[model samples]
Target: MANLYAGIEGGGTHSILVLLNQSGEIVYKGEGPGLNKWLIGLEECVSRIGKMIRRAIDGIHMKSGIPLKSVGLALAGSEHEKSKRELKELMMDKFDWIESVESCTDAQCALSMISKSGAGMLLISGTGSCCQIINPDGVSRQCGGWGNILGDEGSAYWISFKAIKTILNHEDGLETSLHDISYIKEAIHKYFEVEDNTGFMEIFYAKSDARKVAGFCVEVAKGATKVKDGLCLHLFCEAGRYLAKHITAQLSSIDEKILSAPEGLQIVCVGSVFKSWELLQKGFMQVLQEYKSKKNLKNISLLRLNQSVAVGAAFHGARSVDQILPLEYSKNATVFSQIEL
Candidate 1:
């Protein structure tokens, strides 16, 4: 029987599972529902994960009873110590065929995607937004992981919400310094399938759906990129500035040397929002440039992972079991943008 490893990236919106052979080749892939314990109960989350794993194994015709060497899970809302321990124990108990189980936060798994030395920063701006930094000595600091109500800041939901609010303000005759908001207004109405503000309210406020709200960001991106709407363009640039703040908030805590190092600070930018880099670059670079100059930093590099973060979870699983994967971490990421002070 061949040694096999499993990695799962469990997010609030969706989850991905991958199976890798001993040589670091991915053999099977599967997807399941969101496994955030805060959004879905722990039992339901674990149950969905278990079913996904079983389906993957069946897909590969692995009925020979050869146990998986280890399973790595990077789950959202599993950052707490108690949640991590419970999830690990539950997975082990549910699958006697698994030899070991390691669970960690999804952000940590993302960090592993590029930083083999476990020293770097990860900025996430998906359905939610947050920044996490780990020093060379393994100390970790975080900023802006709050849910939508508190402070998603540069998230898709935030951008969408801002667009809607701007429309509402214009309708109420409160916003006077507006350029052309017709594109944003039309896009919002079409996206929500509503002709009026009342209809939009029912879907957004009455239903209390954050995911649906966040989905509108795609339309905003289209407004900026395809239609060239001024309002939409400004919204994206604003989101970029907010995201840059997530990085700057951690600067004081990180070692000054790391910030000024010749290699430059590597910041891993994750999430769908980053896909609109061209639209976001203006405000993003503006904020970063000002910060770098003031702090006297040498340079900063932003990168995006080339593969699914599940691969990193697999690497973590391999490491937890005292096994080394043949994969090269350097080739896993591509630099998106670099700014010099």
Candidate 2:
């Protein structure tokens, strides 16, 4: 029987479900709502995830007669042990045939997407930002990810937060722009179709919503990057530094005696924040280089692109179904195909 594997990359905003075959090719893909149990409650989260998984399974079963053998999920709210256990138990109740079911945080999933050694750092800067370090002994530590209220310094929300403040300051005759981005204000106005202060208020004051404001980072990034806004560039640079600080913090916590990094640590990044942007990545890399040089450490290297996070989950699931392996081990990116979103 040609069994299948399922990977569900669940986040605060959206969830992606992917099915992989024996050769690790994507067979079916589907999407569902987020699995943040804290926000949506445990029952709803599990229900939505179960629905999406079944949909993907049904799609593949009809076309290829593949029975789903295992499922590996990386969910947003599963970072805590209690949440992880809750999600795992709920999922197990629904899916019993899945012999090797495993669940963990989404960052851990992103980590699985890259390295097979299971001992590397993963920096995820999407709507939120966090740096995770996993040593050889399977100990994991995190930096940032304090959510929108307290932390997440080098994330999309942070970038958008600073960009909006600059805009409002400029409107108030504060001239907070870093460079000649006058054209950007016009572009932003056109994009959002805001003609007056009232329009601006409506955009920002639409219930004082953080996500509504943070969502504008995409537009702000385009405009600022196009016009070469110095302030925007500065923000990304700062973001890189802040992210490096977190990475370095994790590095300091690790006992150098056990970890054998003959060369240096390889940091893998995944998320919407780092996808296809020259200025941000450039800024990020530059800061990292400077930081490592000054610290006189082994010097960390970056993989930059972190594709196939969901596919990584699928690979682990498939592996679990096939053999008795370590519950927490990394898988290589080369073993999986591109996870088409």
Best by lDDT: 1
lDDT of 2 at 27: 76
Best-matching candidate per TM-score:
1
Worst 10-residue stretch by lDDT in candidate 2?
A: 332-341
lDDT of 2 at 195: 83
lDDT of 2 by residue, 170-282 (tens): 77888756555565566556756778546767765565544555566677666656866666667676676676677767767665632335535666776677653455655
Clashing pairs in 2: none
**Candidate 1, residue 336: CA error in Å?**
1.9
Error of 2 at 238 (Å): 2.7
Pairs in clash, predicted candidate 1: none
Candidate 1 residue-wise lDDT at 144:
86
Q: What's model 1's lDDT at 84? A: 89
Residues 67-105 of candidate 1: C-alpha lDDT, one tens digit per residue: 888888888778778998998888888878888888865
How many clashing residue pairs, candidate 2? 0
TM-score of 2: 0.78
